[model samples]
Target chain A: MSTGYHVAVVGATGAVGTKMIEMLERTTLPISKMTLLASKRSAGKTLVFNNQSIVIEELTADSFEGVDIALFSAGGGISKVYAPEAVKRGAVVIDNTSHFRMDPEVPLVVPEVNAHALAQHKGIIANPNCSTIQMMVALEPIRQKVGLKRLIVSTYQAVSGAGAKALAELAQESADLLAGKQPEELSPAILPAGSDKKHYPIAFNALPQIDVFAEDDYTYEEWKMINETKKIMEDDTIQVAATCVRIPVFSGHSESVYIETAEHADVAAVKQWINDAPGAVLEDDPSQQIYPQALNSVGKTETFVGRIRKDLDVANGLHLWVVSDNLLKGAAWNSVQIAEALHQQGLVHV
Target chain B: MSTGYHVAVVGATGAVGTKMIEMLERTTLPISKMTLLASKRSAGKTLVFNNQSIVIEELTADSFEGVDIALFSAGGGISKVYAPEAVKRGAVVIDNTSHFRMDPEVPLVVPEVNAHALAQHKGIIANPNCSTIQMMVALEPIRQKVGLKRLIVSTYQAVSGAGAKALAELAQESADLLAGKQPEELSPAILPAGSDKKHYPIAFNALPQIDVFAEDDYTYEEWKMINETKKIMEDDTIQVAATCVRIPVFSGHSESVYIETAEHADVAAVKQWINDAPGAVLEDDPSQQIYPQALNSVGKTETFVGRIRKDLDVANGLHLWVVSDNLLKGAAWNSVQIAEALHQQGLVHV
Candidate 1:
């Protein structure tokens, strides 16, 4: 509601960062000043906003001076280094990395699920994982009604979640494959997991692992879902498990989730709850062949939930299919939304 | 084992039928003569088996004359029409369609899971759904160790399950998209579901619905997972729910499964059970980044199980990642395995 505020976006050259700029343009929050921050390698590059050319600045500890809000998305390492520096300069930091999500002092926020938790943030707030954010939007209403006991989720993740380069790799490699090139002949340097040495082609394949491997035979991506859900839900006792997979999709993360509630739940009531929730759209009309699809969800801000049903024989079990643009709700839009919420709640100083 | 037995393969030249021929070449079942049958359109086309060219004949009432064992994979419509004809000719039919899967007289069989059910087959045996077969292969061993109470599965299925033309569409459309063509500009005559009026581009996208839409907002693919699971497990009381998704992968099907057992189970004990099973392979070493990946399981016959873990808060909940070549273990290989089982058990005769 303020006339204008100073906002700084880190990782300005990345996938989510570009979306943040777009969202900021359409936002009601008046941006009197904007700073585009990226690594030294991308410094001096210009991105146009509001018919004005803005040069990307190399982010340093001193970069956040006079900035009211800093959005960090330059991976966990960059976030760990620069997020605290931004907070020290009196900026409210909304991090889009896993570095601060599980931290006891950081408030993990999904506005629809836990906007109130944002009030307790000590300078830095954490954005939930892309797969987790979309699911939370779809399930929080049901959890409010029946009280969730357990959740099991499997994701169909897009290449864009990995970054712009990964998306390019999918497009290029796919073109190569169809042009009579062997899969092994095409060099793969950026899929399945970036840090891992070997890269498998994801153009016509599904990689079962996301992120690097972790203890207990689960990928770090799966662990992030398990740990972040507990933090966002504010319940360490809630049962959660996830299997993250990278499919050929260019945008949107789709998940198949099954939940058990504390009370016996009917599919109809749960459907009603999802349809009524903010930022959630119900597309569940199986009789007419209507449901959420990835192609239909791109560039959209709403979390689409459909295929809602109860377990055939379980007392209180329910199933849902959830999809959302990963770069939007999963990253940039969530960060911008949090900035909007903070400004509305008078939590930020201009 | 018999030295020679008259055999028939219905639905010959289809996706699964082609793989069935390859599997039979490597199988040990003795055959005096082999008969190939298909719809009238595909009839007279020659397919090679064991280096011999055999012409396909039109499937009709008399097509099963003197056949000892028959494998059917065309579709439900073909099976409902000609399966009884095969039975009337004194041949035992193993159908890979849903036509007779739920019938009281037909036995649903996964040779490794419930080969004993083959004994109750009046004349036709039902092969479980492609997605269901892979999960059962991975879970049945653990269930025998600790009884299963509930199951939730989300599948990343390949377009090849839709048939050969679908695979071509996915490849061609992907090429068209990267070449800067809009998906709508690329005509999709096949994919997602061929019978459905509308077609979706499977290139770089995920279609949440597979097969046709069924009652209760669940897809026929999802219903098949639920209904076929109970029949194969021989327990209508077990809880099951599924969301089937079609990804761009050309071959293997991957699933994220969560199960609750009747007794307390740990990840280690469950891992041991799967490692000990005949057809199940445990590839769950997260430290080395070893797990079941669709790229690695493309030409293999085994069902790969990995990412096994117990839910942090639930006493009996466990999660698993399962993948197998949908054309092989899910269909052709399982069908051929059933024939081998029948021959080994002295159930087939000329």
Candidate 2:
């Protein structure tokens, strides 16, 4: 491993950004110095990392100067404008936004699924969406062994994916609800999608729409999962449908994924394959009441899979319950993992 | 319509039973006497209906002696034991339990989807599962126009489906979590599946398993949806898959349903048919950000349908968001609707 690499994290004050710092402290990357960068609003705020209080600097194009690796998580707009600048400054950008994920030159990667795709990136290695990342980690093993033909997934996503304010909204709404206030009275400021016209409370309910409705009536989040799965897996023949719903959970995202494999396999063999898969932990044991749950997956990096069931009617159909921390495996840890992969492959510097 | 006929409501104090009593008050069924029956523990307790306070009677085979219509919302075991007695006592029993749902002699009826099935009932009509009832109401109209070939559904079910005690647990757990207690410290008393060995808090989390695990790793709740949909539609060739999950919402059950039709149809045509369907209200308008929601579906009997989008890849595949009050359309209202259908068809006396 390379020693004394300077790392900068954009959007250091946000939910995923803070998690990025937390994950960085625990990461194996040999870092001599770490700089936190966020918007002008969060400048001068200090966050603790490795027991040292580091002051957050205002993010600008100049923030990438002397930085060996830059991890971006502010949002798509910030990444779209600053990612290329960071790359030009000789810092390999591991962007956590959707800005350049679909770019032909950029690699949208989940480290466990397509780390090899990292080799060809032009400085930017995009982290897949939080919901998509966990699913990719859980399903890629199956995809490699049996081949995937179709996917139907419904996500029970956390509000924290929207950022710190959305997490606050859930807490506020819960307090209001417990105080006997009407649900309609609790205005949701940042949920489902911040840009969407209508806001629905996520304290004790499920919002079916996530991100915004794109062309063909699917939300951008749903489309991201469908498109990113194919791009990361490098397969387009897989028919994918996703319902991205935001629930009241604070951190972890749980998905009920049903897949139809291209090749048929026995249930016992599939279970064995999952048990042996990397970065995937099988927690399914019906007799022992072991199953992957969002409450249990919080703050964990490994994708937890349980409730594996063979379909009753379809011969090749399989069901899996996958759960992971949206901030960890979904975004921050994934972004840092890409940086680790870059350093391991001797490709950190542009 | 029948006038001055005796009506018996079993399981009067239960969640669905409470809603059943509420629905009966607004129903068109003319009643001379209304008898409330529950366990012997709740006997002698008085409940008010039509401004008359009637004492609750213990459930017994003789309780249905002169009853013209009997509504049962107790567990399957109780229904299995007492529903037959009600039928033998000359009451047209509308069982809101799973005991008779698959019985060859019984007609599984969703009044909006298959009211005609009631014509051949052998003195007992079976109400479909709460999750199944809402989806059937939303999709049967489209199924009539363009036949359905396959279905994949993931349910965001409410805690009330587990009964009033489970609802209480959700509220209690939420309070504990917001008060800064640990998740594991907040002991889950009843949720996800009450009869299961372990319980998980549903306050800010989702449980993938609703009922106990059944054949092929599918929960009994999921299997009911698969089997009930086929039996209610009277088609054995259609393929169905279900993942029943319990969310924190108290009453409404929301479902993300993906369907493949036998014939290709335009989105506008499908929306038009849904607007015209009985017991199904179209609330879909992406432009105005209007869609069905669990919080908004409370106390509503009609299944709310929205987010109707045709698949971008498949020619005949369609996706829909279906929501309804599980206590209303799911249990009490469906049972009462079956009773109304029997009266309308002059079969109330069996």
**Cα RMSD, each candidate:** 2.0, 1.3
State the TM-score of candidate 2 restricted to chain B. 0.98
Worst window of 10 by summed lDDT in candidate 1 chain A? A286-295
lDDT of 1 by residue, B1-350 (tens): 24677778888888888888888788888877889988889998999988999999988889888888899998899899888888889898888988998898888889999998877677888888899999999999978888989888888898889998998899888888888987678888887789987788888888888998877667889899998898899888788888899988888899988888999887888899999998899998777667787767887899999988877667898888899999999998898889888878767643
Share of native C-alpha contacts between chains A and B (below 8 angstroms) recovered by candidate 1: 0.84
Which lDDT tens digits does candidate 2 get at residues B233-269?
A: 9998889988888877887999989999999978999
What is candidate 1's CA lDDT for residue B322?
94
- Interface RMSD, candidates in the order listed: 1.5, 1.2
lDDT of each: 0.87, 0.89
Candidate 1 docking band: medium
Model 2 residue A277 lDDT score: 86
Q: Tally clashing residue pairs in candidate 2.
A: 0
